[model samples]
Target: MVRLKWRYRKRLRKKYGRLIWKVKNRKGRKGFFKSTVHRYPRRNYRILVANEYIAAHLAKSLGLPVARVIQAHVRGPRGRIKRGLISMQAKGGQVIPWKKAKKKLLKKPHKYVKQAKKLARLVAFDAWILNPDRSDRNLILHKKKSGKKYKWYGIDHGISLFGNPTKWNLRRAKKKFSCKKAYKFCLHSGDKKKQRIPRGLKRFTRDNRKQLGKMVKKIQAMPKGKLKKAIRRVPKGLLTKAEKKFIQKVLLCRHKHLKKALKRVSKHFA
Candidate 1:
């Protein structure tokens, strides 16, 4: 039973990002701010700030609709960490309740048809990064007041990639990749009888495999230099050089195996 220590370069005065104004309350607002402001060394999950930046870049590069994320500096309990992710809160979008929505759509299957393509692309993006936290809360259903149309925007990617609270330099975070983990819709669970599929993944039907495939190809096509530049923008003390390289390797490997992995997940819908 060993504890992982997160290293922070508190004395480094060089700031890597711009200052973000503090918002009053994010609960009901469209754009929300995610900060490790008060979290010091002990319980702080600073890696999330970096992961959010990386995830947002990946999502946008593949043409997925996501909240715009920017680098922001936050003053916290221990010291100020320049590497923070501030997601621009979007307005006029209603959050979807997965359980009720699922039950309602299952009863009247036609309701699912409209969103099938959008959901498929989202699923493809999530599947690429091994996102285990695409709960109903992360999706914002933007309804147009005048028109009878809406689009679902995916957000909250801090817990994606290596899973929640991805502590720096954790061995488990760098575990050997397997197709079993790669193709998994929900990271920690299997295709067992009682296991529940991720809420965001439910709309990804077998019929939308082509959409999924298309999205995956876009992800794979992302320039390596762009990926490196995004990763390099992370706060100085958050991750070591080796850890950044490891993260890149993991993503490249995932992109390579995405199609095969996606097929496995798609089988469940069939």
Candidate 2:
């Protein structure tokens, strides 16, 4: 795979996207970032972009496992990385291709299933916290030391903070443990009596609930001025009255709630 030079074109990419290119790196091999997809006019593109940036930053601050964003530019103001622009590039880590994940995770239990559940529990907390736009495809499965474990890294937040207004609908994602591998895990395990729930999943979800609640509590614990100052660092335009109203409708506005937030987080304890 070779890197392609970025050119400022009036139109978006073609059937396969012009800016898109496959990149081979030391750790992972993936396609180059598509500069045009986000450029096309759509639903609150600027706000959505800013929201993605905000989500990534906020997730990192709260210590959630997320992808490291790389800001790239073909051309910019005075030829530097455009201040408000971001683009994806290949990075280290075995980012599992979604196409093959279901087959692998489902065809019996070819290992890595436990790790998948653990990763799901961890990321599910992220989903619960920000209630961000997440899908099975965004998760990456990779092997680990101490007997082939698995880890999940969150990706694609552009649709998160500013995507659909229905993100905070907690009940939308049913509590039924239905990860692709969950079924396989049950099938392959010796215990055929109903799908077995792993101890690790319970512990992982419990810890995630604790962590997010802690993060919310920490924010609530902070002095008002400091909290305001912190929120100010987020991109300005991303904060919209409609968005705020939507968040409030879903009850995820920026406010101080130590015990309440903790209770809210644990309520979805799966």
TM-scores, each model vs. reference: 0.67, 0.47
Candidate 2, which segments miss by more than 4 Å at Cα?
A: 1-44, 73-93, 97-132, 143-147, 164-270
**Each candidate's lDDT (Cα)?**
0.57, 0.40
Residue-wise C-alpha lDDT for candidate 1, range 57-128, written one tens digit per residue: 777667677887765444433653444555665565444434345555444333543454756687777777
lDDT of 2 at 141: 52
lDDT of 1: 0.57
Give one digit per residue, the lDDT tens place, for model 2 in 99-196: 34655453322255543433433433343234333544455455444536445556555444333322322233223222232212111112222211
TM-score of 2: 0.47
For residue 18, model 1's alpha carbon misses the true position, in angstroms, by 24
Which pairs of residues collide in model 1? 30-89, 30-90, 31-89, 37-76
Lowest summed lDDT window (length 10), candidate 1: 9-18
Best by TM-score: 1
